[model samples]
Each structure stands twice: as C-alpha cells, then as structure tokens.
Target: MASNRPAPQGVYVPNDDDFGGYDDDSSWEEWNPTEESIRPVRGRHRVHKRGGGGLARSSTVLGVGVIAAVGAGGMATAQGGKPPVAIEMPDVSAVTDSLPEAKSLPGVGALISDGSDDSAAAGQNVAVAAAPLSAAGVSTTDAEQGTTDAGEALRARIMEQAENQQDQADDAVQKAAEEAAVKEAAAQAAAKQTAAEKKIAAEKAAAKKKAEAERLAKLAKSYTLPVASYTLTGTFGQPGSMWSSGYHTGLDFAAPTGTPIKAVHSGTIKEAGWAGAYGYRTVLELDDGTEVWFCHQSSMNVSAGQKVTTGETIGRVGATGNVTGAHLHMEVHPGGDATGVDPAAWLRGKGQSL
Candidate 1:
C-alpha cells in the first residue's frame, strides 16, 4: 500500500537518548548539527504512531536548542565582547541627551541605547571631563575683554596730554613774540630822543661863539685925545723926569700957544682954577668917581658943575705953568686919589692901541 507525509523544515532529528532513557551500553552520542551532518531525502514515507511521537519529540528538542543559543548570544553582547564594539548614541539635541539646567552640571549628556563595548564607555567618560574646561574658557575670555578696554582708555589719556602740551607751547610762543616787538619799539624811541638832544646842544654852542666875537669889536671905537694938535713931550714914570714934587706926575703934550684941549671921556667938570705949579688948571670927574686934571693951560672954558661929553674942548694949550716950553700937562686920578696908573695901559682897555 502507498503512504503520504509532510517533510521537516530542518534536518535535526531527535533520538530516544535525548530523553535520558537508554542503558549505559546503548547510550546515543550527543549530536551537534553542522552543515555536513544532516540532510533531507526525497522520499514518501509512512507515519506510524510511535514514529510520529518520536518526530514530535525531535521538534521540541530542536526548538529548545535554538532558544539556548540565542540566549547565549544576548549575554555575550552585554558583557562587551561583540564585533560592533562602539555603539552609537544620540546627539545633544535629542531629548534623552539634552543638557540639564542645573548649575552643578556643565555639559550635555549622551543618550546610549546599547552601550555594550569598552569604546562606548570611554566616549561617555570624555563627555564628563569637558564640563570644567568649558567653564574655564568662559573666564579666560572675560579677562581678555577687560584688558582690551584698559588699553583703549590708556590710549585716550595719552592723546589728551599731547594736545594740552601743544596748546601750552603755542601760548608761550605768542607771548614771546609780543614782548620782542615791544622791546624793539622802545629802543627806537630812545635813539630818536638821544639824537634830538645832540642836535640842540650843537646849535647852542654855535650861537654862543658868534655873540662873543661881536662883543669884542664894539670896544675898539671910543677914544679921543685931550688936544687935537699936539706932540707928546714926556711919558708916565720917566727915569729922568723933573717936577715940583721931585718927579713928573703927569704926561706933557707940546702944542701951539692957543690949541684947544678936549676931554678924553665923558665926565663932569669938578674945578677950573689956577695953581702955583700948574697955571690955569681944570679938574673933571667921571661917573665911576674917577677924576681928570688938565694943567698948564692958557685959559679954561669949562666951569664947576658943567657936564662934558667925550672929545669936548675944555681949554687952550699954552706955556703958563712951571715948564721949559709951551705945553699941556694931563693927569688921571682914580677915585680922586693923588697916585695914577700908566695911561697907555688904561687906554688899551677900550680896545685902543697906545
């Protein structure tokens, strides 16, 4: 008779020894399925009640073996022994990896679903170490900003000081220029004043010299003799002079018997008289109290208290006194004293040469 049955999906088949039912001598060796150990044959087979039961048991044992192998694979992955050692985690933007708002934490947390290797654990540890470094970088940047601000302030101060110094220098220069101009003006004025003074002094000296020369020429024109027609017979203080007083006291002039005698200067007639030694005599007094005496005259024409001008004829010359011949004696008395000076020297004082 023909038979029909379904084929198994895997090649594993269980034996009775799988249930621990065989004696020691009939014990089955353990089956480890490999690629070459089991294969399916193309044949129709009959199902027996006892054989179906063995097949069912075989399927159960195979199912149990597959379960144990998958459990061991899971355990090996957990213990950090898989080929994919580094497991990927979520970034900081993910909900599970977001940074906390707490001040105690400083960095983002990583979201790890399968952290099954040594490298994954090392990456998480690196994230923890970065927190303190980020905080230190913030402090360093703030210090650098402060230093930049200080440098700007220092530069501003230096510029202000330079401007002030320039202003002071300009002011000093202006003041010095003004002072120099004032000094120059003063010096020019002083020189002009000195020059004017010198000119005035020169003019005064020239005028004084001219006045003195004119004064000297006016004194030479004022003298006349006692008699117009006469000859000098005796001089003043002659060594061999003879007279009534043992010395000749006056000058003698020889002339004709009626020659008119005149006054030599302006004076007043004090006397007209006759004397013992001097025959018809006359005396004339001047303004400064000087007196002039004319003796041995032929006759007198002037009387007392009669004023006479210079060169006025007072009497005629004649031989009427104690004399050797016809002549006139002329005598000068300063302040009416008896003695007299040399008449030649006195005539020269009026710019006349004797």
Candidate 2:
C-alpha cells in the first residue's frame, strides 16, 4: 500500500562539519527538488522544518548573498589562498520586479529597474554598472582636458592685451612725430619773416643816404667863393695892432690892389660906399636877411640895390684904410647885424673853400 503523507521536496546534507556549526537560532526553509536543483543523489542529507515566515526571510538573504558573491568575483585576485575569477551578470529584471526597489546606498549606485525588452539598452545598463571600477581613470582624463582648455584661453587673453598695448605705443609715437614736424615748420616760417624784416630796413637806409647826397650836390651849384685869386692873410678873431678893434673881426684876403671880388651868393647889393676903417665897403643882402661885407676895395663894380648872381664881379681889392697891406676884408652878419661871424666858416658851410 502507498504511504499517506507526500515525500520530501528537496534535501541538502554536508559530508563534514561545514553545515553543523550553525547556531540553534538559525533557521532554514524547505526547497522542492526539481531537475535544476544542485544536489547529489548518493550523499547523506538532512531535512529542516519549513515555515511561511521563515521562507520569506530566507529568500531575501539568498538574494543578498548572490549580489555579494558577484561583486566579490569582480575584485578577485590570484594570490595566497584565492584564485582569480571573472563574473558575468545575467539579465535579472524579472527577478527584481518581484522585490521592492532598493533605496540609495553609500558607496553604491541606485538600483533602478529597466523593464524594456531592448537588448541593446539592457547591455548599456550592464556597462553602466561596471563604471565604478574605472571611475578614477575617467576622472583623471576629464581633469587633464579641463586644464589644457584653461591654459589655451589664458594664452589667448594675454596675446590680445599685448597687441592692444603695441597699438597704443604706436599711436603715441606717431603723435609725437607730428608735433615735431609742426614745430619745425613754424621755426622755418619765423626765420623767413626775420630775414624779410632785415632786408626792408637795409633798403630804407640806402634810400635815405641817396637822398642826402643829391641835396648836397644841388646846394653846391647855388653858392660860390668870395674872391677866387687871393691869399689868406688873416683869419677872423686874430689879435692885431693894425685893426681898429682890439681883435681882427673879419677874414682878410691879401691880393694886388686891382684883384676882382665876386658876390658870394645870389643877393641884392645893400650899400656900396666908404664905412670909416672898412674903406669903400660894399654890403650884399641875401634873400634870407643875411649880409656879406667886402671892405678895403679899390673900386666898386656893383652899386646899391643891384641884384647879382653868385660869382659876379662886385668890387676890387685895395689897401684904403688901416691896412697892413693890399687885401680885401670880408665879414658875414646873420640877419644884417653889426656883430659878425667868421666869413671863412660861413663860406665853407656853402660848400666853398676859403
């Protein structure tokens, strides 16, 4: 006859002390054996009590254990008592859907579920999960690229500033050169103006000199000497015993008794007669009220009130009164006064020699 109770679903037994070291409080759940169950047919196995609450707790612990094993496999090393291992994760979206989404954890990325059927997207998620291992390398590459970009920008700014400064310097130099050129042009203009002024002054001086020379030439043509052929016997203001005055008052020309005397300038004869010691004196009155007296004359050729030109015969030389020898005495009276000036100097003033 068949037994009334159902047979055990699955079993696990340890050959050594590996499974016997669990604490008394530790609990396990029963698993049903199927074709996929990893159990040996001929080993000694043990059965544990099954409970609904314990089944949920055992499933959670088993999922955590599987994740930890996969993470450790990625970091495995072939050294000392361990061997190297490579971990390849399978798609687990179906399994993750049955559980609540895990909250964020420190030192681990968030557990986000992707329910899409695209194989390429699932592969990308796997690639992202592997990123934590290469985080250092990726960050180093980004930092170097940032540094290079910053250096290039700084160099460009410095070059722009240098070009601006060069432009300013060039402008200053050009302005200074323009100012210098203006100053030099002004100096040249001033020098030319000064030279023109000097030239004008020199021309005026030459003109004045030319006018003075012409005036002198015309005056010489209008005046003449008193007696042409005569010897200078006495000068005016000579002290002499023969003169009636204590000093000689006129110029004396010693000549032969009949020497001719001419009018000294163009004038009218004022008087022609004896005047005491001035003996047969003749007086000539000029247009400007000056008088010329010729004394000690042997004879008078011009009468009173006769107009005569310069160098015309007016009298003859003689020793008629108070004379040391035969000579003509001549006196010049400005404005026709009795007191006279030197006749020699008066004749010289008219461009004539004594």
Candidate 3:
C-alpha cells in the first residue's frame, strides 16, 4: 500500500556521475566457471551480480525518492521486530505546498537548475521536502491529536478560573456576614447596658424621694395646732371694716369662751397681756427667729421670755383684742418683722393642713 502511493515529485536530479557502470555493449564480459574463481576476494569489495533483476544502477535516484516519500507522508515503520505498521497517507500536494520551493532544497536545487528556461519546470518540481519530516516529526494523526489536546487544555484553564472566582465570592460573603454578626452583638450589649443604667438611676431617684418624705413626716410630728375643737371663721387678707388694718392680716379661729389655747410649737414666750387693740394677746417666738402672735385671748398663763414646749396650754379663748366674736386671731412674723405672713400657710409649711 505504501508503494502504491506516488513518489515525491521533483525532489532530486538525474546525473551520470550518480551511477558507476558501463553504458555501451562493448564493455560487456563473458561468464565465470570454477568455485575458486567465484570465491570472494578477501581485501576487496563483495561485488553482487547485477542484471535485469532490478534498477540496481538507479539506486542513488531511488534512495532520494524514498527519502522524499518519507518526508511527504505514508512511510511505513517497524517497531520491536513486529510487522511493519501501515502509515496513513496524507495529501502529498498539501505537504508539498507547505514546503519551500524546490530551489531551496539542500544540494538538489542547484543541480536541478541548468541555467536554462527549459529546466524551470524541473526546478519548480524539486523542493525542500524534508520540512514535514523533521519539524512535525510525524504525519497528520499526531497533528490532529495535538489540536484536540490544546482545546481541552484551554477549557480546563477556563473552568479552573471560574471555580476560583466563585470561591472568592463565597469567602467575601462569609466575611461580611461575620462582621455583621459582630456588630449586631455589640449593639445588643450596648442596649442592655443602657437599660441597666437607666434602671439604676430610676431606683436612686425613688429612694431619695422616699427618704425625703420620711423626714417631712417626722418634722410634722413636732408641730401642733394652737387650738383644737374650733371652726375657721376668717382667713388671712379678708377685706372688711372689722379691725384697724383695711385687710385682715391673720387667721381667725372661732371657739367657745373658755376654750384652752395651746402653743403652736416649742418656742420662747416673747410677750403676753398686750395692750391697745390686742386685749389679752400672747406672742411666742420660735427657734428660727419667727414670731407667732396669738391674739384675742381671754387670759394669759405665760410671761415674757419664758421657754415653753410645743402644744402647751398658754391661755383661754374669749372675745378680746378687737374681736367681733369669741375667736382666736393668729398671726405669724418670719424673722421677727412687724408685717406678718399668712398663719395658715405658715402652719402648712410645717406639714399641717389648715
């Protein structure tokens, strides 16, 4: 089958010097006879008998043809003493077209050129045919397989790159999620701390308020009303023609004629048995330099500068000291001033309701 393929064309030139033999019939010789005459000479070449068996004289041209065929494809090969492996034939024209011009082939191109336009066709047919054999190392089978491997390699690289990118994306998302969770945990801790601080502050404020209330209750116990079992007949600042002042300056407590009047709080009795419009008045001065005036009393029991305890009976209630009815008119002077404040409001400051 390899022989059925055409030999590579124009690869070598014919020359008389290539074949060493006589061409004319005059150089022919007659036959041999004895075995000693046919024995091979020791120091000389073993000359083989040549006849019409093959083109033995054209062996040089035929060797060039085999080399060309090897270059052009379809050269069978033997491996490991096995039968010769059949080689696939490629298009000789395709292989030749890829090679350099016959003029470029080593040693063959110059011999093919005879310096005449008539030999141009032979020059064109000869070529640098060895390019396919040496550069490619094999026929189209290896080349086709190489192309397929290159494609698969490129695809594998693309897939690897895609997988790497996906891994990167997943890592980024996980990092973001972890950071968000940390932030959320920090925010929750801050909120709980704030709530605890607020609760502590509220508790402190409530405790302070309860302690103040207890102090005020104890202080209220230290005070007492000047007279009990009495009715409030007139309030402070009552406008009427009942006294010297145009407006009433004290509170009036209406009681029976012989009702006992008491000291409002622990204080020194400043003055008693007052004259003029105050008929039987008693003045009590407290520790804070505030004076309490109990007016319109029937009689007095304490004198000036006498220390008296709170709620002590000082005098009896009667119609005295510019009084319209039997009542006790009480007035208060803070820091011992002549102008008095409302006695009802002053008692209320001691936690007493009028």
**Each model's total of backbone clashes:** 0, 0, 3
lDDT of 2 by residue, 1-354 (tens): 322234454444433334233223323456666553433344344323455766888899977875676586564432233433445567799777876535354433323435779878677666666544433333344455553344454555578789999999999999999999999999999999999898888888888767755665566688887777888988999997876687889998888999999888899999999898888999999999999999999999989999999889998999987787899999999998889999888876676755
> Candidate 3 residues 198-231, lDDT tens each?
9999998899878867766776788888888889
Q: Rate the local accuracy (lDDT) of all candidates.
A: 0.69, 0.76, 0.76
Q: Using TM-score, give the best candidate's number.
A: 3
TM-score per prediction, in order, is: 0.38, 0.42, 0.46
Model 2's TM-score against the true structure: 0.42
Q: Which stretches of candidate 3 lie above 4 Å from their native place?
A: 1-198, 236-248, 275-279, 351-353
Give the winner by TM-score: 2 or 3: 3
Q: State the lDDT of candidate 1 residue by residue for 1-354, as single tens digits.
A: 333333334344445454333222233445456544334333665334574797888999977865676566532122223222232456757874565554334333333223456886757766555444323433344455553344454555577789989999998998899899899888988898888888888877777756644553464444566776667888777765356465667788889888989887788899998976788899989888988888988889999999998888899897886878889888878899989766655555545444
Off by over 4 Å in 1: 1-222
Instruction: Pull out the clashing pairs in model 3.
Output: 102-126, 102-127, 279-321
The C-alpha local distance difference test score for the whole of candidate 3 amounts to 0.76
- Model 1 scores a C-alpha lDDT of 0.69
Which 10 consecutive positions of candidate 3 have the poorest summed lDDT?
A: 19-28
TM-score of 1: 0.38
